[model samples]
Target: MKRTLALATIVALSLSLGSCRKKNNEPIAPKPNPEKPAPTPGTNPTPGTNPTPTPTPIPAPPTPVNGDNNNTIKPDESPVNATVSIKLTKGARVTIKSDKPLTITGAKLTETQHTYEVTNESGFGIDGDPETLDLSIAQATEFALDKEMPSLKSLKITTEESLKKLSLQGAKNLEQLDIAGAIADEQTLDLSKHSKLRLLALGNRPDMIGKFTTNLGKEYPSINSSNPSTSTSFKEVSLPTSLEVLFLAKAYCALVGADNLPNLRAAYIYTPKAELLGDLSFAGSTNLDRLMLAYTSGGGALNSLTIKNKPHLRDLFLYQMTIKHTSIDGLPTNTLMYKTTNYHLPSIEVHNTPAVKILSLLQIATNLESADLTNNPDLTEEKLVKIAEKLTAVKGVNLKIEADKATDAVKDAFQKIGWTVNK
Candidate 1:
């Protein structure tokens, strides 16, 4: 029995030894593949350190004069002045203070996109009597009292809401008036009392424009108010006979039958169009000198810019801006000494003007001593020289010509005009 048991145990021991060797001899399993690569130590990008950074958002726009969006006033806010009293028919940001010679500019009272009912709007209700107190619409519905308006020399009612019956009656000493955008609820405000008025700019006041502008001659002797957009005729807008210098821009006045501005010396007109020939006469002008038309783009041609009447016509400045054009015709050939006057014609400036003619008399520009030709590219050098050659009697003329490339054409013109051409 002992021998059999030893033999079995020996067999069992041999099997166990073989199994242990097999397990020990097996190779270790290869490492499994990772999903994502591991980052290098200390190589991560910070928020602002990235090459492409995110942009910051922009802030909102600020509020206006009478007040702003928030009732709260900020440190960088603009202040209000004392000379100009502000009034509003809406909620806004406003700053109020005292000033001298009350001048209000840079504050634009433009039409807003939202059309809130003015009368029903919280800030739009009409306030107390102007006879008793001047008004201000700075903080919502706050009405300041006890302060009387002092004598004002120049008053500008730029905002429509600020125009009140009380204010106009009070400003007796006002000389230069620019109530351009204002509107009075009452259609008529008797301005016949403003007898001392010299310059008035009430063009955009559509309602009261015709009433006052037409009879300006009777009310304010020497007036400069422009004809409104709504005014159909200038029957009432007669320039005062005593007027010396007249400046009218974008106004619709009849120059056709208009004649004999005898006392006028300098006339400046800028409109869409103008025609001065038939009844256009400026004779008997003792001291007339300059005629300038700026931005006269749309207008009828002056077949007769008759200088026979204006021997004193020294400077002619015409800048064509619109599709229409302007001209100086009927210049007398006997216009001698018109260039040497105290305020003589420095040079005739014509830009974008069409149908230019280098007549025998216009050739007197050779004596111009100094000629300026810019933007009048049509006046070629050859043509200019042809005109300059006529002034052989006058002393050497100083000519100025600007063109692209300073071409041979320009050089040839200078040569013909007896100018030592300078490259």
Candidate 2:
């Protein structure tokens, strides 16, 4: 009985030892790592490096002017739709009140950027008695102020299409006004009321041709007419008395009222397609400084040019044109430069112009041509020779000069260059 019990104990011990060996040889699972993150999908993982995260982008803020919360606009915000947009500058502001909600675009936010409402979808008007209103618009025809705008100082309107009509009444203090784009054939602005206007720039298009009328109903002669003589039928457009600087581009009109503008200092007209009809006279403009009439690409005839009583006239440029009659009486005393290229003047008098330093008379006409410089006491022999050298050496040119001014050298200089010098 004792031997059997000992054998059973030995068998149990062997079975326990076998079970312990089997448990030690089995495979074990590892704990998850905390330092390294898992690799992103479709990415090649390094030996033991963590992947970088992508950052999110922040949005931009709204545009602000001088930290004013009201005059702020986000970049992604939609633009306001407006028929007429006014861009105020130089501390000029106006508050426009309307019956309905109206959108006005192209107003740059400034310190004085006041909020404004359009009167209606079709028009605009001022709310209170604001002085100055500066604005520029495109793709519009007519934009007239509803009320006087009593102290209004300046105004500017630009359009993509031709401006058919414009009206701003009771703007007596308006100093400057600039209008661009094509003006209609019958468009007329009676600026005689704006007596305080100093600068006026009417930038008309090249192809537009219009007439000048004292009365709006009656039509005068066309500026591009074959006969450019002052007729009893021709009417004059009334200008302001305080107009100092005037710029007219592609303006084909019989502009006849320089006697009214006593303070006219400078006038520039560019009429590329029309002839300057009638006596192109500036009879009463005493303060005239510079006058430039450029018919750049046309053969327009200036019938008579009268710059009478102009003491301060310095520069005069008549490019690509024809002058019918010009005498020494028409020349300004203080005229420094007189240039007329591609010209067709039969005779010109530059006898007593002491301040005449630069005289460019290239491409003179071939019909009965003559230039008399005999009475020029200020022009010496040296000055005459220098003037002769500057002239374009066209053959068969006749030049009459003073006997004292025409020396052997001066005669040789003029004669060698195909000019007949008659002393």
Candidate 3:
């Protein structure tokens, strides 16, 4: 009865006490380890952990992977900071990300004007995946090609300053590339990797090379004197098999594998100072249509001309050549035009062309050995008379023709030019 009364009294006292705590005697959570710094705001910290005994030192700046001047890029630096990067000598690198109109100043009208411009400009200002790209900055000394531009089919770059190096490894699908004044330091240009490249135009200005003084407060006649030798012209070129049209002005590179290309359609090469050493044999080029060669003011002469198997050749223009051989063999079945001027060959044999409409051999070194036009079915009576009047070198030379297809006037015109008409 006394224990029960005591329990009843304790319950009555606890019920009478307030719910709020008046005072607490429990030891405060042991003061957080004072030596340890507070956890970072977002980081979850272990309650009773120890700090690192020794602090780690910050690493020094990384060294450039290339040479002292940092000319070449590091492998880790493949990610470009911007869409395009341009760096001038001794200047901070600049970046361009805006889709501003980039102009090709001296672009050809016959090639790209119809597709790119209404006036005389070839500009690229598209928002995405532009087909053409022209980055022709005059002051850029180093061009970084870290970003891949896959949709670009045509590219033109012109730099007035010394372009130490250039690699088109970033442009994967280029078709036409024109870099006329971008004088490079490398002696050889290898384009064998560009499998889709079809048209190419490249040249260098000789007078604009080396040091030059500024004029009228502008960077006038910007020069590239990276190589000051007289033989600074390109020594070798590696052309791709897919090349169809080529234009090289002031290019002295040897035509090493140029004739082995089977898809070459047209080639316009002008070299003024170096002799093309190899025989310009186009026997392997079966699809060649037009070939224009002009070599002036050099000892450059054709050692030999071979067109043994070309079937689609149409136009042949040879200027200022000293062809060692007398005959240009294998005039294709579809030849439409053949003209040679300022040549030093003694004779030529043109035969077995049924599609020839124009033939001219002006300013040759000597008269022809014979003029054979026997199988040309396209030489109608009126066309025959016109062709006979233009063959001034046929004077005192025997001319063979299909007499049954020619009119009396066609025969009379050949006889008037001193040609011994042979039926």
TM-scores, in order shown? 0.32, 0.55, 0.49
The runs of at least 3 residues in candidate 3 whose Cα sits more than 4 Å from the true structure, single-residue gaps closed, are 1-87, 90-130, 139-147, 204-233, 338-340, 346-423
- Pairwise TM-score winner, candidates 2 and 3: 2
| Whole-model alpha-carbon lDDT for candidate 2 | 0.49
Sort order, TM-score high to low: 2, 3, 1
RMSD of 1: 32.5
Candidate 3 lDDT for residue 10 = 63
lDDT of 2 at 243: 81
Please report how far candidate 1 places residue 182 from its true position, in Å.
9.1
What candidate 1 gets wrong by more than 4 Å, as runs, is 1-236, 254-263, 275-279, 282-285, 296-304, 321-423
- Alpha-carbon shift of residue 38 in model 2 (angstroms): 74
lDDT of 1: 0.35
lDDT of each: 0.35, 0.49, 0.48
**Candidate 2 runs further than 4 Å off:** 1-127, 204-237, 274-277, 327-335, 338-346, 355-368, 372-375, 379-386, 398-416, 419-423
Lowest-scoring 10 consecutive residues by lDDT in candidate 3?
A: 208-217
**What C-alpha lDDT, on a 0 to 100 scale, does residue 301 get in candidate 1?**
47
